[model samples]
Target: MKRLAPHSPATLACTMLLALASQTTPAAARDADKPRPVVDFTSCAKPAWPKADLAARHSGTVTLSFNIDSQGKADAGTVVKSSGHAGLDEAARSGIAKCRFKNGPGAVQMQYVWVTE
Candidate 1:
């Protein structure tokens, strides 16, 4: 099987999404009343693509719901929206749990998108 390049579209898209998520725009700052993302992506580690899912070309977005402790640690997440594949959903959930969030002591719902290019 051919492996994806380090800079593949999927990888690039994930990086872009993380970058966008970490930025606080003037508009966002102005709209401080609005809710913020559950966790911070600025220093979050990227989730690895499951080898089986990658080999099978499985892709979709998984929405997760979970709680963040006061210290920014996340609990094991519940899958609010499945990626149509168990492996993908589990990988996303596990990866998200490992992230260090900026906000804490609250419930959060977030999504992780998986795609093939």
Candidate 2:
């Protein structure tokens, strides 16, 4: 009777490769939570500057924290920080709501900056 060699070089290599492929590395998992529908601020049309604030040369940053659901849509979160201008704050929220993410079920925060030159 012939016994199977479980430790054969070829067999061992195949097993190791399989194990590695099936296991998710920490780095991979960490990077897995990526935004979908890709947030391209460069392409995002700039929101209109509030007339009153614009005239005064107001500039500020709004930080928003939100959840990305399974469908990759922003689940309507809140502004973690305000930009001191209602218009800027609302604009930041509006743009965020339009975003979609992938590998989510987690929190996402973004900052929107407004400046008048």
Candidate 3:
């Protein structure tokens, strides 16, 4: 079977959403009012679908929350919500950690939804 491409619309959309969020307003301004630091996802690492899951056509969503350092790197990610499949949850967690965001506070959220075609 042909392996699924690493970059999917879901990943691209999520990354784009992050980028747009970062570009919308100044982090300093956001920090003044919002308790959570606004993060701008400037970079992305696409999540890989497990071979077994892909073969089985499994699908789910993972909600990830993590801290972004002042340097705009993801750190200390937690699975806010599981994707049901361990592989998907792990992939999303790893992927979220690889994401790059604008320098701000530590709190940030990212949701990864996987849908089989």
Candidate 4:
């Protein structure tokens, strides 16, 4: 039988955190347990993209972090992680910035994807 090498402290810590995070209730579910965000993606306008160019030129995920204010409005958040393309990231940011949420409490994190062939 083969044995794997031991994980470093950092790696172990990251694994533990990931496990804990996964076990925790999702943001949406937590919100549902309380008052749901008034401006959830379902209610907000879907972000639009340049389909033709996107399909031909770019493909990746745009991880955006935006605050859903008490009013349910989506305040402009940071791009913590991004897809490779600047244009795609910018587009996602712009789309999210335009969205508004109904009255609610706390902020929410959102991620958008832009894929190409």
Candidate 5:
């Protein structure tokens, strides 16, 4: 009868092979567990004074901070920064509300910019 020793080469080779196999298996894939935000801009309606502003005059960017729940729904967020115009800010928020993310667990910060043409 022969007894196998723990430090034998056969034992080491078997252990290494098991570790390699586990690493290559797709079942071990890890899902992203971080927070992220999805952002988008809504098409601006014709400006009241398009003739004077030419779209560029009222063009500006707004920054919004929001939390995405595990289900990937955009929770009502705060307007961290504004484009100095109430209309533009509202537009940005409206666009953000329409955006959706994948079904997962995470959160993110995003910015939406609106420009006049």
Candidate 6:
């Protein structure tokens, strides 16, 4: 049996970005029992892996928290969870900021995983 190094390329696994269950603020007149709408990222471009991070083989998942404006634009994206790497975290934050959701005026949180090829 052979062992692979932790930082080795063979040990790296890329995970697709996943949008977890969302939470929304209820409108003043809206019912509390109604389900919140899902965020639609139809116009979002995928985040690019930071060149330096990739060179150093940094990998982790970044969780971003943000609010979507009425125009469907994500505003004030903050890193609720760090990926243990600044580059990866910033990449996720900037990428998500450009996203436009179909249903907006609410809060959203999503995760982006970074792995070396």
Every candidate's lDDT = 0.70, 0.57, 0.63, 0.54, 0.45, 0.74
The local lDDT score (0 to 100) that residue 26 gets in candidate 5 is 38
lDDT of candidate 3 over 16-108, digit per residue (tens): 122122223465366655544444444665677677776666688777777767777778688877879888788778866876766455566
Q: Highest TM-score among the candidates is held by which one? A: 6
Which is the better candidate, 3 or 6, if ranked by lDDT?
A: 6
Model 5 C-alpha lDDT per residue in residues 47-95, reported as the tens digit of each score: 2322232223465566665555666666765676786766666655655
User: All candidates' TM-scores?
Assistant: 0.69, 0.58, 0.66, 0.57, 0.49, 0.74
Tens-digit lDDT track of model 6 for 11-107: 6655557675465445623635543435555777778777788767888888888877778888868998899999999988998788777655667
Which regions of candidate 2 fall more than 4 Å away from where they truly are?
1-45
Candidate 3 Cα RMSD (Å): 7.0
Q: Candidate 4's C-alpha lDDT?
A: 0.54
TM-score of 6: 0.74
Model 3 spans > 4 angstroms off: 1-42
Flag clash pairs in model 3: none
Better of 2 and 5 by lDDT: 2
Q: Predictions ranked by TM-score, top down?
A: 6, 1, 3, 2, 4, 5
Model 4, runs deviating above 4 Å: 1-39, 50-56
Range of the 10 consecutive residues with the lowest summed lDDT in candidate 6 = 28-37
Q: What order do candidates take by lDDT, descending?
A: 6, 1, 3, 2, 4, 5
lDDT of 1 by residue, 1-117 (tens): 777675566543432132213224576567567554466666567788787787677888888877767788879978887889999889888988888776555566777888766
Residue 23 lDDT (model 2): 19
Better of 1 and 5 by lDDT: 1
